[model samples]
Target chain A: MRVLGIDPGLTRCGLGVVDGALGRRLSFVTAGAVRTSSDWELSERLLGIERGVQSWLDEYCPDAVAVERVFAQHNVSTVMGTAQASAVAITCAARGGLPVASYTPSEVKAAVTGSGRAEKQQVQAMVARLLALEAAPKPADAADAAALAMCHIWRGGAQDRIARAQQEFHRKAGTARRARGV
Target chain B: MRVLGIDPGLTRCGLGVVDGALGRRLSFVTAGAVRTSSDWELSERLLGIERGVQSWLDEYCPDAVAVERVFAQHNVSTVMGTAQASAVAITCAARGGLPVASYTPSEVKAAVTGSGRAEKQQVQAMVARLLALEAAPKPADAADAAALAMCHIWRGGAQDRIARAQQEFHRKAGTARRARGV
Candidate 1:
């Protein structure tokens, strides 16, 4: 299973794609941002991000997508921007036909560094070590996205177990039905 | 000034455009939603919304944009979707070159119905009366968008005051600079 992880932002969204079944097999598919002039209208900027996300979705065709979740903030402006980033990511995932999962900052940190309160540098260093990369992902946000993808893989495996259990239950039930009929 | 209000959503985004200036005539211009099939990919649906928003922005050239602020939610999935909506609205405003303003749900309701605890129907009723419409805007989300826009106009006037003050300050400084001749 291919998993795509995204760190969404209005100005920049960092994305990482990885092979879900094989641990530590990650390729830095893309890392950059979609920027618009300050003078440009909001719609134009949104469209730019949409286009960029579409391109990625089309190219990657990942089985699943993961994103960062936002918490409440006191600054109205900051909260608003963060909310927008979350929306853009969701929209992209929805469009890509990929099931979307969101991981909170703490959860992502814990998954990557074994501690929810791990510092950014610590998380970055651990992410590099886990993925066996040349260097830590820059801008923090990108690294966080990559880590989120890893968390999803871990979580996703649990989901698979649940699915398998359900299937087994159904199979037994079907056998019981045939036995009763006989 | 014409203002467009957006209630961003992953499945459906409610949009309303109003034509009028503060303390003057106000009229509804257009209101509707950009919707996509849930069965389709999430990213593709986002692209549809982006295209729709871009067309609206290009056609209307709204002076400002207003969106609902995200409130805390107990349901993680709902919260995630709400964040995505907020981000899409903000990005739309940024791309359109329109000043973006956000209002809490209470603020929008209070502005429309004179009570923060007013129900959705009450707020919609008040909006219809305020805009002198024969009927409430269809789909509660659309009415909510309109209410958000109304609140922005009510509060955004404060921004105008700030702008005027800054312009006056610059004018005074320029005059002083001329006198100094240094």
Candidate 2:
């Protein structure tokens, strides 16, 4: 399945699309960053991000969307802005009626470089090699988006299936216990 | 001028609208909350918020929209979700082509109760008195939203004017410096 990955930020948001599935070779479709001027008002900046993500969704038509999950940071304002941008991405995907998934930073690194603690350069290098690119995508953020897309393609579907299976097993167990009149 | 204030949250988003200008007695137009089910997916919850805020904007056509600025919280996920919700409110205002403002919690309290550290009940009671309401709006969140609206009505215009003046001053100063070749 094709997947679109977004590294959400207020000033610079990265968008990448990859076509692949589990146990299959992945190919890069497109990747780039959407930037907004800091001089603009917060509302305008958010609108710009919304429009950018919507355009990518319309152009790529990926089967699923993956977003970088916001985590706690020392700077409250930065974290807040990232979370806001991430939310816009999620909302846009839902508006398009596409499934959405989120992966943590370490998860993306691990999936791409086989090390959760991998450095940025290592992840970028591996992403380039996996996609057979002439060079790593520029601005690092775009490469990070590529890694996120690959991570989702490699692991997201399997994880969802496992979660669903676990839910089903629990439901059957509960029903069986009810039949025994615990 | 009419002002609409939003208290952004995942489950319970508060909305309040007031009509008046600086130095005029403000009157309550409406106050309520937009709620989303916890059982819903994150995307669905966000879409519900977007639709709810959009409807309010369409109905009220407020001169300005005010959102409660999100702050750091002990719970990372909760704070992230709140920031996301606030972004949706801002995006809606921008989409409607309305100017948007944000007020911190302390600023709202101080504007309503004359104390930055005022208690929730104090702010609520003062909001009721300011707007001549029969009683404080219910769900506390709604009352807080009312306070935010009043705060914007009282302070936002002056702040915008000051910002514009500063910008003009800098522009003139830069031109004079260029003339002086310094």
Q: Residue B144's C-alpha lDDT in candidate 1?
A: 80
Estimate, for each residue in A1-182, the C-alpha lDDT of model 2 and write its tens digit: 89999999999999988998778888999899989998998999999999999999999899999999888764776888898998888998988899888899999999999999999889989989999998888768888888899999889977867889999999999999999997
> Which CAPRI level is candidate 1?
acceptable
Candidates' C-alpha lDDT: 0.73, 0.90
Best by lDDT: 2
lDDT of 2 by residue, B82-156 (tens): 998999889989988899999899999999999999988889889999999879998888888888999998999
Could you tell me which residue pairs clash in candidate 2? none
Please give me the total number of clashing residue pairs in predicted model 2.
0
Give the poorly placed runs of model 2, Cα more than 4 Å off: A74-77, A160-182, B73-77, B159-182
Supply the DockQ value of model 2.
Answer: 0.57
Task: Residues B1-182, candidate 1: write the lDDT tens digits.
Answer: 78888887767788888876667767888888888777865456666777777788889888898888666552545654566665666676675567887778888888878999999889889889988888778777788878777777776765777788999999999999999994
